[model samples]
Target: MSLNIYHEARSEPQIGQLAVAHVTLNRASQSKQTVEQVVTAPKQFSWTFLQKSYVPKETDIFVDCIQTAMKAMTSKDFTKGATFYHRHDVRPKWAQSKTYVAKYGEHLFYRN
Candidate 1:
């Protein structure tokens, strides 16, 4: 099994959609299933853990990076918005490890 990540264009420019990278799973239990695991924006994730010193802005580049990374992992092609990481202090260790990295300009953020 694999996880895919990609991006899609929304009706508005600022409001982007960070969709699944779209991966094909090789499972004996079933033929195929397309699941949409929606998540919050990357910036939103950071606010939970970051301080006043760190501020994150949403950018197309950052979103693209997330999509690229997810596609690379799943080997599936998609044009969805990129994936990003947010840090919340109360989360578990396993949850934190399931994050993906998205880069905005010169900065990078993690996505779950």
Candidate 2:
């Protein structure tokens, strides 16, 4: 989960990292899968599909992501149950049907 948050939203602010973390948690709960399953599922998180090492190189940022992942587990979800998100620069076809929830840092959040 920390790796997902780091690779996906490391450039984002703390709030955005939290949002991504919550999306992971929300997906896990909704899909009846564990966090690892939700994170490693095919085509779910881009980092998983990208042909590269999963090791986090930025130690400081990775630590921050780990903290964000922990905080998200106990904090109230400000995303209002967003199950999907994408970087602000791209528009995925799937996003057209999902309700726009909010934007935090470089990511936009959505929910079905």
Candidate 3:
């Protein structure tokens, strides 16, 4: 899960990463999908889909950043109540119907 955050959040801000982490955790608990399933569900966060060869190494900063992000996640929080998110550059048909919740960095978070 941390690896997912490290890869997906590296290009985003701390807040963006925090949001992604929280959303992933929320989906993991509420939905039957595992962390990988939640993150890589079709066109969601596409790092895994784009680069299958990518692997996150355990650097001190990576560990610390993910830890902080994970620590900030509460059951009450889900990226400002978003269960879904995607990059601002791409507009998936799925997002057109969902209510926009918040935007952090290059990503736009949404809820069903």
Candidate 4:
């Protein structure tokens, strides 16, 4: 979860990181899967497959992600139950049918 938050939203603001984490949690809850299952499921998080290495290169940022993940576990989701998200710079075909939620940092959030 920390890795997902770090890779996906490390460059984004703190709220963005928390939003991504909440999406992961929401997916896990909705799918009746563990967070690990949701995170490791194929094609769920781009960084899990797109990156050659899972090792985090930025220690400080990684630590911040860990803290964010912890906070997300108990924080009231500000994403309005968003289950999907994509970066603002790209348009994914799947997003066309999703319910648009709020944007936090660089990511556009959605729910089905």
Candidate 5:
């Protein structure tokens, strides 16, 4: 989940990392899924905690950004209720039925 956020929205301005964080948190709230489940749900994100090849890198900047975003969300939720997002360069079939929320950087966010 955090990897997807770091890769997908980390490059976008407007504190896009917060939007990424919000997606996970919002999904957890609406679906009663733990943060892990929401992130690992089939086809939700490209990278997950289970991949054998995955390595946990501690990038100080990435951690800092995500930490800031998480802190910002404690008082008020952002993301415009976005529970889903996809790269702006591609349009997946799942998006056809979801409500468009907003685009952070390279990601276009959506929700039911």
Candidate 6:
């Protein structure tokens, strides 16, 4: 399984992109049966399910928020388009706290 992100720049004011994931499965098996004394049968079955998440950035908050929103997003919100933004003040736990103010309209993006 793997994830792929594609950017589609439709207009200057619009940030366009698409993120997708691909999954593939393979299976193999060997069986043997003997037909004697009223016949006999052998059967086997196996399957696997895998899930993976993809995000635009590696930041902890970004991934966390995306997963959160995706889980909470409704069918309409997903179908139309919904964007989630974070403040510029957002920082990872490893970073030291600092007093900084972000300019207006610093964090923004379009989502679908």
The predicted structure with the larger TM-score, 4 or 6, is: 4
Candidate 5 similarity to native, TM-score: 0.77
Off by over 4 Å in 2: none
lDDT of 5 by residue, 1-112 (tens): 5555655465666456777788888888899988778877886666653453333365865676566556756746667788888878897999999999887777888989
Which runs of model 3 end up more than 4 angstroms from their true locations?
A: 40-44, 74-78
lDDT of 6 at 25: 11
Candidate 2 RMSD to the correct structure: 0.8
Per-residue lDDT value at 32 in model 6? 27
- Give the Cα lDDT of each candidate: 0.31, 0.92, 0.74, 0.93, 0.72, 0.22
lDDT of 2 by residue, 1-112 (tens): 9999988989988988999999999999899999999999999999899864689899998998888999999899888999999988998999999999999989999999
Q: Tell me each candidate's RMSD, in Å, in order.
A: 11.7, 0.8, 2.7, 0.8, 2.7, 21.1
Better of 2 and 4 by lDDT: 4
- Is 5 or 6 the stronger prediction by lDDT? 5
lDDT of 3 by residue, 46-112 (tens): 7776875455565875776667566755434746667778889987889989989999889898877
| Strongest candidate by lDDT | 4
Model 4 over residues 1-112: C-alpha lDDT tens digits?
9989988899998999999999999999999999999998999899888864688999999999999999999889889899999999999999999999999999999999
The C-alpha TM-scores of every prediction are 0.21, 0.97, 0.76, 0.97, 0.77, 0.16
Cα TM-score of candidate 1: 0.21
Better by TM-score, candidate 5 or 2: 2
Clash totals for all models, in order? 16, 0, 0, 0, 0, 0
lDDT of 5 at 42: 81
Q: Candidate 6 residues 1-112, lDDT tens each?
A: 1111111111111111111110001111111222111111121101111222333344653444334324332212221222222234565332233222222233322222
Clashes of 6: 0
Residue 94: error of model 6 in Å? 42
